[model samples]
Target: MQRQTTIKKDVSYRGIGLHSGREVSMRLLPAPADTGIVFVRTDAGGRQIHARAANVTSTLRATTVEENGVKVFTIEHLMSALHAHRIDNVCVELNAEEPPVADGSSLAYFDLIESAGIEELRSERHEIVIDRVCRIDDEATGRFVMALPYDGFRVSFISLNPHKLIGTQYEDFHIDAQTYRREIAPARTIAYEKEIDQLREMGLGLGGSLENVIVYNDEGWINPLHFADELVRHKILDVIGDLRLAGIIRGHVIAAASGHALNTALAKQIAASLG
Candidate 1:
């Protein structure tokens, strides 16, 4: 069995929320084994929320957790980064209601997590291995997901758009701490200008600007730092956060046209079967 690990030091960053548009600061601190993933709201008298899919109460625009009406928002990217890296135990202390959207990707968190260094604990690592093929479907949105057997955790994703710029993208990858950091961590959050305007009308994406996220125009990327394969890479990052809802899915996962809602539904179903 593998051992648990905690960071050797504290690491911090600052940025705005993609939706809320509010500036936030967060710190990653090492914690003892079995701590799971905890989010501490340093802004609200230290309210702590555990990173369990079952605790998810809101996923309207982003993943959110609420305890006694105190909520933490836009947590998927950071959660994905942590789970992808296999850093199972850590205390995420935040000075706001949401984590900073640094560059709108997991890269910042990846760097902080790496800088802290990993120290293993004596306890054996635990994961909810997938023994059966489980799936979830959203008929209204036509988004679907499935988790199947594999030697290790992996993801296959496909988007349903046909535009030359963002059309029919898919990628499959094996997930390990090192591989995720180098391969997927740099993939930034993205959206179309029309969608951005709509979200902004609803008072969302306040933290979203050209600096943090990659914006797509009618013809192509509006951001200067465009990658040929960024679409697929970003999808993989989303899959990481979605599967995290499984509370530890231990096998390979294959999914297509899926989003955060479907991912969490699959997690809830798989978690239910665990009993």
Candidate 2:
């Protein structure tokens, strides 16, 4: 068992959202033990929404949590950072519905949290131990995520893409804050050139650009690859963020072709089972 943790002081940042294209500002404040991570919407008259699986309302292209019609989207990156940092409680105050894209990776958020400094709380974390095999699969897409009993946290992922340039990528990660920051935090979000128009039509990817997003096409990658397996690593990053909604779980997760939807599905299942 480990003590819960929150930042020692308030830290703030401002940028634009990838999907919403809105200018937003956010602050991270320390919270008491067992508060978990809460999203406080300052623009919504100080509405509070807990970051948990039960509150998840959407996973279209990004993980979104909602309560009483108040929604927060594109939280995976920041949540990924929090998960990696093992932060158990914090009040995230945001002036917009979504956080900034932040170079299309978790690096910025990780740095912001580092600046705030983590403080251990008195109470131990309410850990949800995965004692048996738990699995969720999307048959049609061949997407699946599973968790098995393990002494510590780990993630093994496989990313599959129809494109020849990005056919299949695999990576097994033993997660730690240092490893996550160095190996996973810099891996940027990726999109194909072919899907840009479609995404825009769906009112998504409005703030994505060559600067923050790694755009690829059949011709080739428009940007250089940070790691040939960057996509799969980012997918693992998403898994960590999404599964953390179930609280701390002692498990080794194995996933393939999984996305926000499937990740949150597994989170919901684990959370429900624990309750």
How far off is model 1, as Cα RMSD?
1.6
Those runs of model 1 whose alpha carbons end farther than 4 Å from true positions after fitting are none
What lDDT score belongs to each candidate, Candidate 1 first? 0.80, 0.92
Model 1 lDDT tens row, 134-216: 89988887788888877788888887786777788778788888788877888888888878878888888888888888888
Residue 231 of model 2, lDDT score? 89
| lDDT of candidate 2 over 157-200, digit per residue (tens) | 99888899889999998898999998999999999999999999
The regions of model 2 sitting more than 4 angstroms off are none
Worst 10 residues of 2 by lDDT: 225-234
**Per-residue lDDT of 145 in model 2:** 98
How do all models score by TM-score?
A: 0.94, 0.98
